[model samples]
Target: MAGESEYTYVVDFDGTITANDLSLELAAYYGGTGYREIENKYRRREIPIKEWLRQMVALLPPDLDQLNRKALEWVSIRAGFNDFLDQVREQKSTVVVASDGFGFYIEPILKAYGLLEKIEFVYRNETVTDSDGQLKVINPHAHKICPVCGNCKAAHVVRIKETGKSVIYTGDGSNDRFGASWSDQICARDRLAEVCDEYELSYSPWEDFYDIIKIEKPDLKDCSDISLCLPQGQGIKDGI
Candidate 1:
């Protein structure tokens, strides 16, 4: 079968892949006082997410090895995720991880799960040491006005849609908001589920990914059949 003819899935790394956002968890573990300050600023809208990320990274020591070690030690792949991924593979669906978070943890976590090579693509912040010996946050796209805390998931939606492939998205936080808004189907939990209800978007709360492997619902549910379906004109491309 042609690979492009197969389905494509874009997953959010933090809460979607694991149980929580590794970047947020990383901040609590590494950023110290500077992290709290940035969080408050973001909550208050005192700074745009782009600038906040710029500032947040400025506070971290340029310790790539240390960060990688910590991520390997504490980060976890969500329950049932590996099996769900395998099911996707069995069906010839491509899986991509698009994250606003840094790549330091993502690469290692996927490696730990033996999924690093299988993932189709990864979009995230790069790592570099700054003049002050702090890790610098590098945004290749230098985005502006992200919908979530510090990055724009919407942009990823646009990129994925450009391929004109059928896409499925799974996530937990509002970071997946605009992206979920564009998916052919979406599975979410907690805040994102609430967002779906409020916006009347197509979505369902996922307990874990075991159902994805064993059940037929997620892969078969059509957004158009639901009352909460987004308008025909929203999302990454022509909104279809």
Candidate 2:
């Protein structure tokens, strides 16, 4: 039974865990006028995500500190995530976050919410400032043959699945399609749900972590916590 329950959860950070897309939000304000066109292109599938990201990042101001500050100020996470993490930790489940965005802002934001240490690994583009103060993106997990994503979430899932643990993937974007397809179980929301529908892939749809807990892992639903669970009718809030 112990071996049967061993699960590794690969979650998406931006939209799945958070209520809003942090990078897109930041890019809207800081990415200048050129960001929108690239975003549109990506949305239309005229440009691949990797190139779209490159064009988007090129429009930013190269101030990592300011970018971090804006994210801390504007970004928020989905409700009940801490409790979800609590349950995962209690079960000793491995949790990994795969993002199509940058980690420069993700680290600080998670630290602020006290969730940094709970996450085993974060797979995303490494954002660094050059000597001239220009931002550079380094993708260590990119697939040589795949041109879509800067970091291949599917590849990570495949590797984790090789270890004989069930891989449960949670995400809410078009980019999540590949990874979610390879997972043993999928919890999808928003756009990813539509993708699942289009492909006829089985998935659990959720509004927030509360839905995820109530629907997928009911055993952990009654688990106790103050900030993690809310009274009936108060409704769940978004983000950390």
Weakest ten-residue segment in model 2 by summed lDDT: 220-229
Which candidate's TM-score is highest?
2
Candidate lDDT (C-alpha), each: 0.66, 0.76
Q: Write the per-residue lDDT of candidate 1 for residues 1-240, one digit (tens) a residue.
A: 224334667788877788877677777777899899888886664775556667766655578888788778877678988777777777877788877676667887788779887777887777787686768777764345332234455555555555666567778865566667766678878777887886778665687887545533233223333322222233223222
lDDT of 2 by residue, 52-108 (tens): 777777778888888888888988789999888887888788789999887678878
| Most lDDT-accurate candidate | 2
C-alpha-based local distance difference test score of model 1: 0.66
- lDDT assessment of candidate 2: 0.76
In order of appearance, the predictions have TM-scores of: 0.78, 0.86
Model 2 bad stretches (over 4 Å): 1-5, 215-240
